[model samples]
Target: MLFEKTYGIDLGSSSVKVYSMIRNKSYIEKNMIAAKGRKIIAVGNEAYEMFEKAPSNISVSSPMAFGMIANLELQEIVLYSMMRKIDKILGIGSVMYFAVPLDMTAIEKRAYYQVANGHWLRKNRVYMVEAPIADAIAMGVDLENNEGSMVVNIGAQSTNFSIITGGRIIISKKIPIGGRQMNEAVCSEVRKRYNLQIGTRTGKRLKLVMGRLADQHKQARKVVGIDSVSGLPREEVISAYVVNAGIMNCVNEIGAQMKVFLERIPPQIAYHIAKEGIFLTGGSTRIPHIDTYLASYTGYSFNLSDLYETSSVTGLEKIIHDRELRKWAQPITQRKL
Candidate 1:
């Protein structure tokens, strides 16, 4: 049954998500690997645990960055280990679909095909689907209808915007603003306000709960960092005000970019989108009141999809199982391979 096995892979910058048709379930893990020298010590969840805490000689990092493969060798090790660790029957003959970022260049696209083809899948059985289309399908949008819809995926490294009409992406744009930027904003605020240096993880934690200044909860979180004044380890309590202040600029920038994107869209497509509203998905959307914040700027209601982190893979699963929906996006086919 190797030839019959189907898998949907979302090779995200922050995490790797897999959907197995044989098991009829999806698996997700942080897209990180920990290693010493040439040997891989751990991958996925285990590697994620080492991040920000691992000692010297141990390096933990993601193979993909900004939704593109930055290290092919590391990516090979990461994917090979991740797939096998999840299921032994993943390699060879298994049809694999990858959710690819829209702004990827030709070389970057080829790199993705190479990663899948190098192992874990039959050479030509690897397919590519635009990340936005996958998110749209997961949201259960009627892609076949003449009406158009807009999808906004706010990921760790970037925010992707795509206008889908008749099951195809009419226009797509990617902005280098996402959770990472928000996290940095928080970090900057902590340093400037409290004279404390916090890790990215700590900043992200604050943003997930209180990203909006308007809805700042009366909450405080204990954070450990170096005291800028003393240059020593210090512990401080950070409030929602600090967190919101850190993320305010990044969120505002996202809203401004979305407005510009909509301004460039043709009136016909814009009309359809205004009627259908906007679909918001991605890990960053998990931020509290983010949809409401964006809705204020876009002038359209934002509907946050359930399982936003896994939406792209869910869409891939739908396409693999529903033949009638295959036309929603074309796959990169290699008949000769």
Candidate 2:
């Protein structure tokens, strides 16, 4: 029961994915926590089920905010709860490989190290890997080559853009527009145009179901929401066009940032990006025609990862065994502790 093992932990704002080297499989779950007073009642998928639908006494939320650790205590609780569900904790010297945001500040990076080294983890064995690099590896890009490639991850709370060459990140940037913002925009637009106030979950459902390119299929769905005037629940027919328009602002923002990002890179790298096409990953990439929409705006083709959401963890799994990939790992510094 005290077997030594290494875990690849991708703790994102929307979900937590873990890749176990010993088990050779991955665990994926929504990164949610439901608390009643000071006590945590649930975590992961179970807590996600209660989001936006929990009783007044129970608070359901993600411990992370804007891709960084916001509530240290809550994050620790959620991390421990999840680890326990997977296997028994053996305490000290249990190696862990963590996928970290490339643009995070020193303090933010410290938060991740601290959480992993907290009581239940192996403080000295915690290793860090850049999230975007891991994603690129998972996508089958040869980071060791002299050629360059660009990777864009559209997460729940933030989007990360990285320019990579020679197995290292040359330039990386993060924007604060993601799935949550898109859902909020959808809710706001629906309320403005239809006088219907919808829940976060409902808005998200509509975005995924109807958010598509201009020429994509036009379908309609019945959406239930509270009427602004009556404050009573009512049903309204919402078309894909309306939903598409609602989330377009977010899509355009991402495109704008991409244009800016490309402008800053060297011409040689930019040329590589053009030939390779920008790689897209993360849960938000699943939105219908998102790549096409981004391509139209940027004037370059786009490539999407088949396992966008779990790409980082999958790459982490690969790193544990591949000596060349393991060279990218950065050991936790003593100064941070």
Candidate 3:
């Protein structure tokens, strides 16, 4: 019998996370790719470095957008490249578990299978675990007895709000607003106020360094950008208030939508959610006092998860190692008729 390894994967728009059962370790890297026409130049962090800096001849971009695979070929390339780094032989006979979005179409779901079974990973077996289910497990929610659990995952390019009960997802929603939009918002605000043109990456840095909701701090960071007037590079001091203003625009919209979602759900679930605060996890949740801000907006407390971006992958890690939790991961490929 051939030896087989187990792996858990979460392919996020910002990054790709993988857990190796044998090594008992998880690896994360930017989910980016740089290519010159059809030829690949770099993948992962190296490619991310080239983003917005690469010459016009070279294209640097994420293969994923809005938590979905936009470029299957590039996505496969990224997966294979990352896996090869973990296992030199690429774990040819590995059993792979993927944390996937619940709102995906059949074609989008099939893309996961294609990526796992394509290229150098053809010998691998693939399974699907709903991203929210993985998130709940990672948040220490007891899936089997879950009366009602709310999870709002604010990812890089999108936000997913979901409800899970009795080990199943009852409601799931994916909104296009996320960290990316916040970054763009920052750029817009900067251009409007500072008369400086900055890239989304720079906007992202400003957002992370200064974004705040409650107890607003007066902080400033020096950033270099093209002056909108002269069209020349210049350094400017960007204040926290400006950055937070941009971030809050997106957060307010998300909170408003959350309120509507809560209103439509059953009262019983709302009761349980009220008793046990909403579970919040995602990369975007790292913004300072975002939980407090959300609570203020929705009038419901939130249980902030430190796991952040790794929540879903961490849940997949547990599901991969725990036999009892294995039931939550379903086989994606059906047997041929």
Candidate 4:
């Protein structure tokens, strides 16, 4: 079914991303939902609190893995509940325009289609679009102008790089390294250095507050984690040098991939990216000097978006209003995905 109103979803690893736009206006937004044993016990701000604060009875886990729906039943239940809650909260419904990774196959795309379309109330008709294309649009890369631009979106599961020209997505792919990997690397380092075991929360804090690229950000952050020996909590301060060393390995991986993609890009479009430079999005973009690190290796300038978190949704909001975008996108019914 065609929808005059649209709801855009990101369905990220750490969050259930959704936004609604009526004929007049829309907001860029999301909810952090926590899951355990296939049940969604909490959602939104409550779920976010479970990150470092939940009791042992709660095990907060990411529902979306590697940019795909890892648990369909949990995901559907989560979506169904959210839809019902949103309906009550907003008193409006619309079709869903969702973003999936560029690397997902036709089959995976079909699965999203199936779940989104199958629901009874707000059984959504999904319009599938790669994240970066929306990123380009959000970055205001004019497709008709064809001024080339690239976007590097670093998130929990994977880092994605996509090249866009004239408002069309040209090449896009995913690298395995991401925020979770950085968190794990920090945990490994803390274990080796201080004999402390940290949870995902502590590791993520290190990534944000203290994590740096190798030879960048010389300061360190004091970290707290579980005491490996005493089975109690422990605290220790570590230099950015150590944290940097751990996460820099992942940063280097992205740089290497960027160089490879740059080499493959035709000189013509490559010029545009080199001129307009690369755009950075996703929550991971906030890590200190990530752009600087990328620049050091690639020697290509990088641009930062003001609305990094909301840009993708804002871009899709624009797309939803475009007849051309609707025509190019295949309407994915919930049954097909």
Which candidate comes out best when scored by TM-score?
3
lDDT digits (tens) for residues 116-166 of candidate 2: 876655454788999998998899888877588999999998999999887
Off by over 4 Å in 3: 334-337
Model 3 residue 27 distance off true place after TM-score fit, in angstroms: 0.3
TM-score, predicted candidate 4 vs. hidden true structure: 0.85
User: Which window of 10 residues has the lowest lDDT sum in candidate 4?
Assistant: 22-31
- Residue-by-residue lDDT tens digits, candidate 1, 1-337: 5447778899888998989888898988888999998888988889988888998999999998888888887887777777786787564666778888876676787787777777544454677888888888899888778578999999989999999887688898888888888899999999999999988988887787666646566888888999998999998998888888778788899999999999999998888778778999999887777788888877988888877789999999999899887765455544422
Angstrom error at residue 164, model 3: 1.0
Task: Select the stronger candidate by lDDT from 3 and 4.
Answer: 3
Select the stronger candidate by lDDT from 2 and 4. Answer: 2
Which sections of candidate 1 miss by over 4 Å? 1-3, 119-124, 329-337
Clashes of each: 0, 0, 0, 11
lDDT of 1 at 173: 89
Each prediction's TM-score versus the true structure: 0.93, 0.95, 0.98, 0.85
Decide which is better by lDDT, 1 or 2.
Answer: 2
Q: What does candidate 2 score in Cα RMSD to the true structure?
A: 1.9
Candidate 3's TM-score reads: 0.98
Per-residue CA lDDT of model 4 for 81-104, tens digit only, reads 666655554332457788767767
- Candidate 3, residues 239-320: lDDT per residue as tens digits? 9999988998999999999999999889999999999999999999999899999999999999999999999999999998
Q: Give the C-alpha lDDT of model 2.
A: 0.86
